[model samples]
Target: MSAIGTRAGTGAAGWVLADSWTMTRRELAHWARQPVRIVVGLAFPVMLLLMFTYLVGGGRGVDGDHAEFLVPGMLALTMAFGLEATMLAVTQDLTKGVIDRFRAMPMFSGSVLVGRSVADMLQSVAALAVMTGVGYAVGWRWHNGLTAALGAVGLLLLLRFAMLWTGIQLAMVAGRPEMVQAVQILVWPVGFLSNVFAAPESMPGRLGAVVEWNPMSATVTAVRGLFGNPGGSGGSWAAAHAELLAVAWPVALIAVFFPLAVRRFARIGG
Candidate 1:
């Protein structure tokens, strides 16, 4: 009897882990098959990075090497870019009845959503690595120590995780792939309103104040601080508060959205 109980417990644990792994692998395979989309997603940010660094960068009171200032902003933009892919995948799964099929399976019920989030984060990591390489090619370098470098990576990952939940929530609400485009339209303004390309001080007063406080701006400010880039200024409070806000805002967003996304996933087709 004791041996049977122990065996049953181990079996259950293994089954749960297996379900999660299977879901994660399935999503990863889908990405592998869609290499072109991945490339396109990555290329846009790199193009923007180059265009801003070489073209618009010099005119904006952006002191120091533009690539360095631009890299941090591009990092935030890349996270924003990832949301569309997540929303599209989730919406596609729902519309094609793939999610329904998963619901019918005996696998862990939450695994599908968890798997998508994991796969997307892996893609984000790859995208970040590629962008970092591109930044290096264009003369961006991290002047901070290794610890600060790692911290910047951590900030990016946290930001991606927060955005992932937001994407999942959007997917749940969208219910169809076609709706993702409409959702993506909202992302552009959020990206543009942030201090990504130029200093907030250069903007008109009211607009600059808003841009300085935008969450993406906080992230850019924090990353620029980490890189020792000089673009962050104006609103002395923001300059002092960027790092804490960067960490807190993402944490708060994830805490709120993760549960909402999970609950939404649980109610699919209900």
Candidate 2:
């Protein structure tokens, strides 16, 4: 009897994986149909990198080349910026009743969301690659070995994964496609409040403390260390433990939002 039950459970898990992969492929198919959207998403961040590196350059309290300071921060910023695209897609699906159709199918719960996230992560990796190439073109180099550079990329993607769920929850909450734009506008302040473009120590005292504690700031600081670039000049405890905060912040966000998003989706039609 126990063996039968174990096989049953394994079969159920297999369906879940298969269903998720199908949904992921469905989302990826949109790239071929809407190639321009993907191109614009990839290009916007490259434009931002060039503008900051040349047009509006100079990061206060940056110890070395500003590109060294800016590029990692920009990578972290890139993760934060494009979440609106995912949110918009989710809201569109919800409004258009695509999710309803999916729900009526014989699929595992939350598999659609899982599939959406996987697709978004693939785009994020593409964005990271484009930004990395552009950063190199603009004088940013990782002084660390390849392993450390890869670790930095890992941390950046971890942040993106957390942010992905948070956006999903918001998209569900917003419910309508038009409301996505309003909710997405809120993301910009959160991205800019970090030490992404400048050192936290260069800000006013209280604001500097706030920036230092921002999740994006934690990631920027940690990645800078990984890439052997200049970090913020802040002397606080958060600054001292950025690597810890970098991991903890994203994990904490995922813990809070992932289940919340799943719960929200589960309750949608109930």
Model 2 accuracy (lDDT, Cα): 0.88
- State in Å the error of residue 238, model 1: 3.0
Please report how far candidate 1 places residue 153 from its true position, in Å: 1.1
Pairs of residues at least 3 apart in sequence or in different chains that clash in candidate 1: none
Off by over 4 Å in 2: 1-10, 58-64
Q: In lDDT terms, which candidate is top?
A: 2
- Taking the tens digit of each residue's C-alpha lDDT, what string does model 1 give over 1-270? 455442344576687787888999998787789999778877888888878887787666555577877898999888877788888888888777566788997677888887888899998888889989999998889888879977888898888899889888988898878789998899999988998877888889889888988888888889888877667577657656999989988999999989999898888778
lDDT tens per residue, model 2, 73-190? 9999989875787788788877776778887866786888988999999999999999999899878999999999999999999999988998899899888888877876788899
Give the TM-scores of the predictions, in the order they appear: 0.91, 0.92
Which of the numbered candidates is closest to the native, going by highest TM-score? 2
Worst 10-residue lDDT window for candidate 2 reads: 1-10
Candidate 1 wrong stretches, greater than 4 Å: 1-14, 58-64
Report how far off residue 258 is in candidate 1 (Å): 0.5
lDDT per model vs. reference = 0.84, 0.88
